[model samples]
Target: MNRSAEMADLSGTIEVARVVLVIGLVFLHYFAYPNSRVPPFEGFDPNHHQVATFVNSFVLFFFFSAVPLLSTISGWLFFGFSARPWEAIRRRIGKRGWSLFVPLVIWNLGALAIAFALRAVAPTSSLLGPFGIDFAHFGLWDGVDAVLGLTRLPVAFQFWFVRDLFVTVLASPLLWLMLRHAPLLAAAALCVAWLADFTFFGLFIRTDVLFFFYLGALARLRGVEPRVGWNTTKLLLLVYVVLMALRALAPLAFDPSQPDQREMLDLFTRLARPLGVVACWGLCLRLAATAWGEVIGRYGGFAFFLHAAHFPLIIFVKFVLWRLVPAETDAWMIAHYAAS
Candidate 1:
């Protein structure tokens, strides 16, 4: 293929992968928010519940790659292809300010308003109570606290991703410099930094974002591509399966509540997440020219729109489902997933 064709193919592959990753993220949220009555096997026997949790958590591990993959793709496309890094940064800031930052602020305020209204109208309703705020008890300080993410209550639960992405973009110039000067050394340093106990500016900077972004930049600088064949893809799959099985299943069989085991599992998952990103990318590349790829690429932009709007939609759907069902039944779960 010609250079332009090759680049388009790669872009299509990444877009398809992104669509899949976002769908996985939706599933992760569906299972994570038990209060939303969306978890498929929630409220079962203790053993059954643990098993279900394990399975859900395992699925989540595969999709944890979603954010990293996004950062990597962004870095690759933004810094990798840029002729002038500083000019690119200025353009990125303007674009992202309008696209990401404005939406974030607007959505969070909207979510807060919705929650406040729900709390006011349905103070005693179970369906609305979880999402509602205690307006009667809510002080100005409480409002500020929620805005700052200091409490369990969030203005918008998924805004963290936007916040982190904003931070990463703001730092991209420095990152691009590092990647350009010494790609391998930069990647190695990032990986080590990812494994370390650290925070930036008193907030926990997502090291995975930095790591994967630099990884992508380094890949572009080094002219790397997803060149895995079936055999290599199978090997990656096997490794992922084994590690996830140990991470997920072992906890169910043992005392998952133990601090040490939980810590160990967290560490294991951190190591496995990047491998999962690579495996998923390889799979996407392998299928990028297939009929399915066209469909995925067609909806890739919609995935971002969905991510932005889905949380409020979920809450609204839950309210509607509660009114229709009036009971916590399997139908609620079915309807919730369908809406999601």
Candidate 2:
């Protein structure tokens, strides 16, 4: 097929993938491990809550790649067919701003505002502690960091994805030039840095964003579609599941919160994510053929809204539900997940 045709097909596929990934993000946030140490989270006694353990393991693994996948889509769309990095940058930043820094600040500030209210209503609530909303010694620096995400992540924290994404977007012009001059080498270096968990304080909070974003641009530069043969798809899906299963079951042998075990789990995560990203494309195609895909597609434009709004909403909803129900049954968990 021609390059234009490939672009068109990938574009359509990406649209569907975006909607599905947003839904996956919500699922990832609302439905997660129950750590009793964390006020907003619950913990299960492995001896008793076998079912909850299994669910958390499977669900967390399945939905872990949303950010990378979404980042890739953004990169691919930004470059487009002709590769106009400056133009795309202008569009995103030149205006009042759409998806990058502007939204990051706005959404994070909104979250801070809600936290302020929560703090006023329940100064001594333990739930407020987890969110850094205890209002203890709160000062100008704290407020600034919480709103601007200057040194640390904002109160919402999930905007950390956008923070990293914006950093890469701003660097895209140089990235495009490098990719144009040496696509394979550039992509390889970025991939290596990402897999190594390379980090710098000033920029690129997550190296995966840099890798996946450039991966998308690389795909466009080479006219590669966002798919693989069924055989390759099966292989990726297998690898992804195996890695996730390893991650889920590791707690059986090791204390996951300990430094050494946490590093091991982080290693597993880095290895599994790329595999999951491709696996998700295959899953996307499957969903696209069904009614569920159509329903998800209808929510495509709301991806930004959902990503921005889900954090504080989940906190409030989860807190209230926990208070009202006072039970952590499987049915209640499912209901909470559905309600959020």
- Overlapping backbone residue pairs in candidate 1 total 0
The TM-score between candidate 1 and the true structure equals 0.82
- On residues 1-340, what C-alpha lDDT tens digit does candidate 1 reach at each position? 8889888898898888778877877766654434432232222123433444545656666677788888778767766554776787789878888877777777777778877666678766554544435666888877764553444434676666776666677777787778768767877877887776344543433567767877877777777865567678778978987777666565445454577765666677788888887777778887777998888888878877777677766756655654565544445545444464
Residue 276 alpha-carbon offset, candidate 1, angstroms:
0.2
| 1-340 per-residue lDDT for model 2 (tens digits) | 7978765555556668887787777766764534333211122235545555555556666677888888887777777645465676567545424557788888878888877777788767655654664376889888888876677777877788888887787787788788879889988888888877786655666787889989988887787856776677788888888777666666667666578877866777777887898888887766665677777766778777878888878766776666665577766666665666
Model 2, stretches more than 4 Å misplaced?
1-9, 31-35, 38-45, 83-96, 230-235, 324-327
Per-prediction TM-score to the true structure, in the order listed? 0.82, 0.87
Residue 340 displacement (Å), model 2: 3.5
Alpha carbon lDDT of each predicted model = 0.67, 0.71
Report lDDT (Cα) of residue 259, candidate 2: 80
Clashes of 2: 1
